[model samples]
Target: MASTTEYSDRESLGVGSIVGESFSILFKNFIAVILLALAPMLLSSIIAGAMVGADVALGVADPDFSTSTSVTTWVLTIVLQIVFYALTTALLVQLAYDSKLGRPLQLGRYFSPALRAALPIAILTTISSILAGFASLALIIPGIWVYAVFSVVAPAVVIEGAGFGGLGRSAALTKGYRWPIFGALLLVGICAGIVNFLAGVFAGVLADVGSWAMIVGFSIIAALSAGLTGISIALIYARLREIKEGVTVDQIASVFD
Candidate 1:
């Protein structure tokens, strides 16, 4: 019984150690972390731009294009956005897990894995978004709960290379630890909110002071905030994987295996 107790304690320590190691990797690979964080925002912007451009070319002048005649345009836009996000995540995970710091991180490396993982990732996104929306309707707390559960979905898809099945897997891994995940996400959310609030306050002050300064400062703040958030999520995912699956960096790299 004592030996069994010792083994159980060791297992718990191992989980804590994995989480620590994940954060260490994120801090150590700061640049990559930033890129991972920014990727989603950048991809969203690109997709939005393309959709707007297509709407313009079609002579459809409306703030909302969902009612547009060309369903293909909307489908393409959604597909492209998913593909882009998946690819970005794949590249980031590949680079981070492989420890390929010196290699030139090109755009192409992101596409294949993204394409491979696109459908599952997109489905996960849709389901999570719907759940979050429903939660919001219920009240703020439910919304937060939904986000916490699905928070690891993206990382699960990218790092574990699991498809639709991975979504449930992530939820399972997060089980019995929802509060901890919630706490970590809450902290990040608070920090991000504060940063945005301060930036907005500064922007307001700066606009009164100097428009150019406001523009530059706002841009810088947005980039930094997005990057930091992305890195934090990626790192969290890595740590969760380690805890749930005993996946080391090496195993993450061997995701295809």
Candidate 2:
């Protein structure tokens, strides 16, 4: 049964192959992926709107973030955003891997594992951000490189229960293939961005009749885009491990076991 989803005989995936595989997985499980992604996407959108609204109310295009209180607030907002992202990303990874393993997926049951992973993932995300920030400080290219390489850390944590070591595990798995990973991810990002821009424009131009309607339209589109991207990343992580370590879908899905 393990061989059912094995990629051991296939050559390692390149940029285009990974992107194609990701979209294939996403389309096959579109409803599940979108539903799993909605909560975090909605919350993130609201947070961003609130921040922008607050800035508008303050009458400052760029507020005094240098102030202690403002800095603290900005930091807290960032932390909350990361926490939401971590939770949502973990859920998506579980969903994607389970679907690939041919498990009967239940949305509610998936949250349990994600909840258990919340704290460790939050910490892992924060540390990765810091490290990526320092790397960027050294050189802008290194920062982008660090982010692309460590992109699979969240999925590693979800699949392998690697805790904080997920960062190292991801780095290890992504070794020698960072360029392809980066290219695939960049393609996903571009596609997602285009979707988002179109959604926003559609909402603003056509759905301007009601504020709530616009918000709902934008949120739904954003959720779909984010969900697809998340699923793609999860697939990328799984295939990389399969190619590099002979890991099977059942092994990646064993977190559910």
Candidate 3:
């Protein structure tokens, strides 16, 4: 997995290399990535807050799921979170390729394609996530494997226009490389988890501060987490394509142009 064999002639799926480059691309375009992620995150948070009190949605207050309002709040929040996640991943996929190619970020043009693909990506991602969640109930490793198998879904849907078939496309691309992909994702996931943990602590501290402050704080952390995860997944998708298809980053970015 780490080294290329003469017979294979494919690029090496270097886990460390992909993880290292993901961080480079992230920090290099940190502001842009965060900003791109923030919009959808904040909007979702605001909507959730409106349905249930901001305090309840942000965990500052107890959630009374017994109430109908609280149940609706949970449902709407979960659905919006998935939709926003799909949109964010779609936006970042383009940005990651552009960042990798050293092209100026095109903030304005990203939304059209991202918006167009968000629902399908959200639907497919929801199905995969549900499967992963169930697998995790029996054992954690199976869950992670399930996630790795369909990990490149958003990139496939957004970049290749691979609608509902994105699941099959991702499964195809990831074949024979699931473990390496898992390793790369695990390393990145740990880093993201740590950051999110710290963000939680920060949110806990802000609980007494005020509603708006906590909203801002929570949105920022959510955006940061999404930015990291989305960026890494985008890179992984590009790397997989390059290794399997001999496609260059420039060629991948050309889809947005």
TM-score of each: 0.61, 0.80, 0.89
Candidate 2 segments whose C-alpha is farther than 4 A from its true place = 1-11, 47-67, 134-141, 202-216
lDDT of each: 0.56, 0.73, 0.83
Clash pairs for candidate 2: none
**Using lDDT as the measure, what is the rank order of every candidate, best first?**
3, 2, 1
Q: What TM-score quantifies how close candidate 2 is to the native fold?
A: 0.80
Worst 10 residues of 3 by lDDT: 1-10
lDDT of 1: 0.56
Clashes of each: 1, 0, 0
What shift in Å separates residue 58 of candidate 1 from its native position after superposition?
Answer: 23
Candidate 2: residue 32 Cα off by (Å): 2.2
lDDT of 2 by residue, 1-257 (tens): 12222333556666787688678877888788878888886676567546544332122246447678876666676776667776787888878777777778888888887887778888888887877788888786577667777788788877778888988888888776666666677788889889788767656754447554555566677776787677777888888888888988787787687
How far residue 211's Cα lies from its native spot in candidate 2, in Å, is: 6.3
Regions more than 4 Å wrong, model 3:
1-11, 60-62, 67-69
**lDDT at 206, model 3:** 86
